[model samples]
Every structure is written in C-alpha cells, then in structure tokens.
Target: LVSYKRHLEIMGERNSYSKTDLDATFMRMKEDAMNNGQTKPGYNVQIATENQFITNYGIYWRPTDWGTMIPFLDSFRERYGTQSNEVVADSGYGNEANYAYMESNGIEAYVKYNMFHAETKRRYANNGFLVQNMYYNASEDYYVCPMGQHMERCGKQHSVSDLGYRSEVDVYRAVNCKGCPLRGMCYSSVIDRRSIKVNHRSDSFKKHARELLTSERGMMLRSSRPIEPEAVFGDIKFNHGFRRFRLKSNRKVRIEFGLVALAHNLRKYSAILSKRMMGRNHAYATI
Candidate 1:
C-alpha cells in the first residue's frame, strides 16, 4: 500500500512534501504491525486517468490498500465527474468489501484472487468420495458436498460480505463412516463433516473475467497496460534515476513521485508538440 497525506500536500513547497504529514500517514498504515505506535513510515499514490491523460493526482503514506480505494475513487469521481465502467487491478486489490462496493455502485472490476484460498481449492477425501462427488452443478450453480449433501445457502451471516446468506453446503456424513464400506478413501479426518466456506463473490468475478479475457477487446485492453503504466514506472526509476527514495516519510515520497509523474507527462506532451511543429516546418520547406 502507498499513500501521501493531505497535510503533506498543503505544507509542501512546489516540489517537496511536508514531513509531519508524511509521518502521520505512515503511522496510520503501519498501526497493526507496529503495535508500539511510533511513526511507521509508508506512502500511497493516487492518479486519476483516462485513455491517455491524468486528470487528478494525490499521494499518502498508508500501510493498507483497503481503506484507500474508496476514498481515492470518490476523489477521482469528484474531480473527473465519473470513472471507467471497468476497473482493472491485480489481486492485491481484491477484498470482499471492495467487491461489494463495486457491485452496489454499478462498477465492474477485474481483480485477481489468490489461488490457495479455500474458495478455489476443492478438498477430497481419498477413501470417502469418487471424482463424481466433486462435480459442480453448472445448471444449479452449487456444489455437492462429499457426503452427497446438497449445500444450499444457509440463511446466516458467514462473513463480512454476507449477502444475507451463507453457503450452507455441508457433506452428507453418515454417523458410521468407520463401519461404512467406503470410509477409508472417503475422508482422512475423524470429523466426517466436509463442508466449508465457498466465496461466491470471487467465483462470480472469475466467470466475468473469463468471458472478458477471451474477447478481442479484452485482449487489446490488457495488451495496452504493460506499455502505459510500466513505461511510466520504468522511466521514473531508470531514466530519471529514482531507484531509492531520498525522503523518509510518506508525504515527501508522494510529493516526489507526483513530480516524477508530472515530469513524464510534461515531457511526453512537449515531445508531441515538437513533432507537430517539425512536421509543419518540413511542409513549409517542401512548399
């Protein structure tokens, strides 16, 4: 997570950030791990962008990325009047609350999920169930528990993203699996119940992502990303020689990064203007 604070922006000179604001924001982000609660240094950068232009910008030193998204998105909306329909980000941005926010606000997002999560991993007991037991009913959009139980949505709050129903899918456990014929290969655990939390939110997005990833437009949109954001980062680090940050606090770091981005934009804009002028001059010479 990266951030620069509002106070930093307010106190900083044209090119530098306020030291006090940077320390405060960094402390906020690192509050959990740094229990002692001294100034834990960190930073976050926010950029409002279109297909080829950055409209608004901000930075802060915050530890977690979770709290910053909505505030940044809202700030972007306030400045730019709205945003792209589909927000594309990597798995680090994936969270239940963020998904709910997207769904509620009518914005679609393409966020990756960690594969090891229970939602994606299907558990199987060697002695208990056959391959058929793990089958997902596409028509029904539900899973069959190992014990031949139909796991329906339990009318309970299972998690933070409780859409008012929890996945009530549990395995059909016969009380006497020890004496049952297929006990050995069916389950390894003493407790025969084989039902767990299935994240439907992640599942739904994965379906949406699959459809979009295969489309021609999706391919084109994805292809452009490496060139755009990566180019900006590369130029800042390599061309501009900004590998290590000179500033310690989040606020100063943000101010510095903002300047770097601004510089890149200005250079690109200047290059475009120069090319146009050169073209006009060449045309005159030809005439």
Candidate 2:
C-alpha cells in the first residue's frame, strides 16, 4: 500500500483536501487488514466495460465507497486524461461528497441512496425500530437510544462485537431504561441501561457520517452501488465461478480479479463478434 501510494504520487497533504493523510489512513487500514487476515481498510478494484471490453477501471482503498468517487474519478482522469462526460455508481458512492466531486470534475454522475424500502420498513417494524433508530447526539457528544433514552458517555472499557481490536470506548446507556415506558421497544436488558458503545476517537467519523447522511445525492448514490456492484459480482461469482479467492496477498487477489474481469470482457466481445458476423443491418447486429 505504501509503495503504491508513493508510486502513484497520490498520497499527499492537501490545502483543502489532504490526499496524503487520506492515503495514509487507507494504507494503515490495509496493513491492519493484512496483519489481521481481514479485508477491513482495504481497496476495491472496479472494471468498467463497453462493448464487452474493459474501457476503464481502478483500485480504490477508501474506508467507504462514498469517498471513493473522487479518487476513482481522479484515477480515471490520470489514466485516460479525458472526461467520461457521464458516470454512474451505486448509493454507497452517492453522497454529497461524491456528487460534489463529480460536478467539480466535470462528470455527470447518477447515484441513488437506499432511502425507502417496504421490505426494510417491514423488518424494522417487526423489530419495532426504524433507520437511524440509534443515533449520536452531536451537541452533547453522546449516543441517543431508540426510545428517546440518552446515554451519557461513560469512560469505561467494554467489549463490542465485530471490532477486531480490543480497546476502551465511551459507553452510553439509558438512565432509566428499565422503568421507561418504551422499554419493550428499546431494550432487552432490565438490569442495565441501554448501552451505546462508541470509539473514543470518533469525531471525524461522526462528521463524515453526518455529511454522507444529510446529502440528497448520498442517498441516491447508495442505491446505484448495490445494483451496479451486485451486477458485476453476480456475473463474476455466479456465472463465472469466482466465489472463492484463487490467490493470497493483495497483489495476487488483484491479478485474479483482473483475469475474471478479462474473461467477462472476452465473453461480451464474443457476443458482439457473433452478432457482427451475422450482419451489420440484421437484428443480431442491432442487439
């Protein structure tokens, strides 16, 4: 990761947007992933196609897809040095940051967030909760429970599920969740308050999150990501038997993914070739 960043001349300090710091953070994550045997803080390789060939592609190592838009565009620009004119991505990459980046970079981007869904609503209803049912209180810098319960930030150590590193965190819990009227909908614990665990160094994260959530384009972009990325994955994993990782290490994984992408392009090209052979003015040709 460090070598790639240096070679690309992409990781660097910025006046308004420090690309170096961002790259450094991503590199750290990659290192962490390598050490821990996880994909967290990793880069994703994307291949764009037209007429069954990879017209453009890139590797983005940002923590979230939202941040990848600008970097992807920048990388594309660096590679082709030409404007795509129009771009399309999923909701994960659709936030204000990405849209603004697209607009600034002279690319018209289409991205959608997964804002509303009947299935999601139904599931939440079953659980008696809704999206953002749990949220952080910025003014007080604490987490607010679903049932309007405020959990004060307690300087305590607690083990959170899914966090690879065992670290201390600020714990917040509903003061009187046990006796609260909304207990049924809020907590399954009677003896303890509704605890909301947060990392100690979470200010920047919180800010970025708010920016992603508040933007209209963010939501829109998220919606497109699932469709586009899912389609890409489905073609690779389901159709091409790429469900298992064929190689170890980031470099090998990249090569393997590239080959899979190459295969996909070849298939697409074959279809086009077959159509062209049929006739220029024929129905197959049109297809």
Candidate 3:
C-alpha cells in the first residue's frame, strides 16, 4: 500500500518508528512501570558536563548508550574542534568500539567495563573455568583450560556492528575436551571440545582501561562524574519541571532542549554570582 511505502521511507535505517512522529523511535522508558515493558516515542539524549555545566549535547535515535558513544563524541569534537583528552563514563559506555576509538585518539578512558563490578568479588575455584579467568599466553596466542589442557589458537570470528565497523576475535579451542574431569564445571550436558572466542584487541583495550580507571586521578574523576550530569538532570527535571518536550519533530525538539540547557546554565550562573557577591571563595564547589 501507499502507507507501507511511506513508512519505509520514514524508517529508512531504524527498526521502529512512531506514526505520530516519524522521526521518533519507540524506546523503552527509563522508568520501569512495574516491569510492564512499556515503550514510548522519544529520542535518546546525550550530554557532556563539566563542573555541572552542560558543555555539549546530542540527540540520538539509537536506544542503547553504547552505540551512541562514538556519534556523541564525534559531535562533541565537531563542536569543540578537538577531541577530549580524558573521558569519564559509566559501564554503559564501555565497550570494544568505544575503547578502541579513545585509544586511537590518545584519550584516557576512565570507563568501567560490564564486568568491572563483578570482578571485585572473590573469584572462587570453579570460577577459574570462565574464559576471563583462564590464563592467556600472549606469545603463544592461546588459552589454558582449567584441566591443564592447552586451548590453541584455531581461528577467528568476525563481528560487524550496526554501524558497519568490523572487528576480529580470535577463537581458541581446547586440544582435547573428551573425558576431561572439569568438563561438568565448565560447560553443559553436550560435551563438545571447549572453546572461547576472545577479542585480543578488545582485551588489550580493556586492560589499559582498567589501569586508567583504577588510578588515583581516575578515582577522583569517577567520583565527580555523577555530580556533573546527575545533578544537572535533577535540576532540570525535578527542580525546573522541564521533563516533557514541547516540540514534535527531532530538529525542533533539539532546539527546544538547547533552550532548556541554556536556562539551566543561566540559573546556575546566577546562583554562583549571588554566592560570589556574598564573599564565598568557592561557588558551587568547582571540580
């Protein structure tokens, strides 16, 4: 039908769209309505903050934060005319692609991986069977199985992202997994030879990221990151009551949010100026 053709045109690259707003994607709302899995038409907003000021912002149709990282950073670079020296973000922004992007740009990434918090727990004896805990020999390019079996480098698996970025992962397969004692502790009922797909590039990136994220300066930045965006969001939504978008389409909505951010910055500046007039040395506690 004509409607199908029009919808195909509107949903060019996206999987879903709202008829009311063609550019709006149906994303899961942040608020969990009692796990009802409610979805609404909206755009994912990305913002960078420094000392509680919204420095740069972007509007994304991508629902997940990980996929939006590169585009958001690119937007920031486009606006600032240079890449950031240091980037601090939560686990949601930590991934192979993001880490690679930062490393190639010489940016210190103080980003936590998906396993960062879980790795803090005491790793048990059985946990040694996990791929991450397994010993990797860089020179040999292989992994050691829990039962002392040598998992040699066999082949590679190629993965292409939604953005069409291709990355290769080296797959290591155990030389022998038949009749191994630790087989039950490792995998399931069907006992094929044990194998693990490892992205060497990503692992290296993650190792560097872990080092940077655990340093003293990294700790301070990580602690301060929450204060930057969370407070601004609270100020705008809770205090200013500027949650709902006033516009319909994407471009208009972006402009509308820009005004909201400007209002927030001006209000914050007014508060700081007032505090300075009162002879306060530090206003709003600069980071």
- What CA root-mean-square deviation does each model show from the true structure? 8.9, 11.3, 3.7
Decoy 2 TM-score against native: 0.44
**Which runs of model 1 end up more than 4 angstroms from their true locations?**
1-40, 48-53, 64-67, 116-142, 145-157, 160-188, 244-255, 280-287
List where candidate 2 sits over 4 angstroms from the true fold.
1-43, 51-53, 60-63, 114-229, 279-287
Worst 10 residues of 3 by lDDT: 278-287
For 161-200, candidate 1 gives per-residue lDDT tens digits of 2223223222322333445445566567776543334455
| Model 3 misplaced regions, further than 4 Å | 32-37, 124-126, 280-287
Candidate 2: tens digits of C-alpha lDDT, residues 138-234: 7887666666666777667755422122445676656766566766766466575666666544333334443554468656655555566567667
Q: 1-287, model 3: which lDDT tens digit per residue?
A: 99889888899889899988888999988775376668999999888898898999888888889998898888888988998899999999999999988888888999999988787678642489888889888897778887888899888889898888799988888876888777888888475788788888888888888888889998899889889988899989889887778788899989999999899889889999987776654543542
TM-score computed on alpha carbons, candidate 3: 0.93
Best by lDDT: 3
Which candidate achieves the best TM-score against the true structure? 3
Alpha carbon lDDT at 146, candidate 2: 60
TM-score per model over all chains: 0.63, 0.44, 0.93
Total clashes for model 2: 22
